[model samples]
Target: MNPYLEIHPEVQQALAAGKPVLALESTIIAHGMPYPQNVQTALEVEAVVREAGAIPATMAILNGKCCVGLSQQQIEHLGQAKEVWKVSLVDMPYVISQQLDGATTVAATMRLAAMAGIRVFVTGEIGGVHRGAQTTMDISADLTEMGQTSVAVVSAGVKSILGIGLTLEYLETKGIPVVTFGQDEFPSFYSRHSGFGSPLRLDSAHDIASLLHTKWQLGLNGAVLVANPIPEPFEVPAPQMEWYITQALHAAAQQHIKGKAVTPFLLKYIAEHSKGESLEANIALIKHNARLGAAVALAYRQF
Candidate 1:
């Protein structure tokens, strides 16, 4: 295992100086959205971290090597190129074996973030149990990674499209903590609340940093789930988004969409059905998480 990870020059200096560095995933750039906008959002989120006084480390696997931070050209390539694998922790070996271009998912990015010594990651939302999981057993690898990785995942809570309530319960069963930022209610990605109470809430990034530091000191492994809500002004009405989600999900089921294809399919349906509002909300929330994650990373660095 040649773990000779390559760090972008700026990220190298930042890490050397013990500066705050936030780990970002590449799936959003490659598999989550269409081109041009994908790359544009990627760059914009990086800029948000930079502006927030922390360095950004966008993780991906390019040409069989783990890239802890991407170059401008690499980002451009990821956006324009097709066939990028949505590499999870288990898929790393397969991706490397095939020497293929791959975008790291939350699970893959968290593993790489730990390997690169990053403490925090920001994304739209973590994946979880799919709807009606009792029979299908469909679950995201992210749940398992959270049990093993020593990193904090910041998001606008779980996407309401999934089994949000069940996902939280699953995390609890795995002994992973689900804490919300400044609120006790778990956010529902597009909405402010998932209609359920969060297990814990911490208002400040400093406080969240304390939780991470204390957990690591106690020798407990796994990551923290920070449910940072989307900005209110940008949030779509839950009722409205729900209408869009239901319609899209129904379309996906009618098409027999399964496995990895489900998310993209549903997202496309929602995007078109909502007149592109869904993607707009997705982009807004992601940028918001980047800023929050960067702040938390900065706080942790000071500690």
Candidate 2:
């Protein structure tokens, strides 16, 4: 056990008993949504995992401890706090050594989850090759982390704010398998289609679990990117959402938002401008991913 890690008793017990456990990121709670909605969604997502028969370990950093699971009060604090650090892989050491409150991004959460022996991690969507990376050379660390981390990440898909085609290409270059659940077309976060074919497709949790087992057992290290589509009723059409994303991206560039600040800024901007349609879609997809993550974890444990 890592001295700096503090696993929740429930999560610890579940691990001890060889039960399925799903790791969830704290970035969604702290920086992804508005106050009350963020807190409410966090709790509901956890409930979804438990209802699916898996323990939910929401990862964060609090007072020098790498917390594997957070209390309700802690979740609320993260949601409402103004000074919480948006901790990514590079920010982990600084946040922990400084004993500050920090929300874990997908990359950071996967690292913590792997440390605690959790296999499947759930998040709304993942950061990927940003738009205009050809010149700016800007890309998210999440992709690099996915190339090495063994924890499987279950997400709606690459965030529509990014270049989905380039992200898929990058994942291929990294030898990271991108598997879409129940669809041949890769999803674009808020939308059910990305105009790109999925490199791999699996229709069932048991089949995905088998793939995870086989990949790792064959010494193919790194995370599997599970693209779970949002429920059809909640999906925003690709064309409309793309227009909104273009507007938001322009806003981000005008404001000179760079690095880690870019993602949250784009997400908030789109949600506010979309009249809550995007926000609702975001919430729905996270819950959807949580359900699938739990089912996959349960299936993985069977092996």
Model 1 pairs whose backbones collide: none
Alpha-carbon lDDT, every model: 0.90, 0.94
Query: Could you give candidate 1's per-residue lDDT for residues 95-116 as a string of tens digits?
Result: 9877788999999999888888
| TM-score, every prediction | 0.97, 0.99
Residue 267 lDDT (model 2): 89
- Residue runs of model 1 more than 4 Å from their true location after superposition: 1-4
For each of the candidates, give the backbone clash count: 0, 0
Give the lowest summed-lDDT range of ten residues in model 2: 258-267
- Model 2 C-alpha lDDT per residue in residues 1-303, reported as the tens digit of each score: 999899999999999999999999999888999989999999999999999999999999988799999999999999999999999989998999999999999999999999999999999999899889999898888999999999999999999989999999999999999999999999999999999999999999999999999999999999999999999999999999989889988998899998878888988899988999999999999999999999999999878
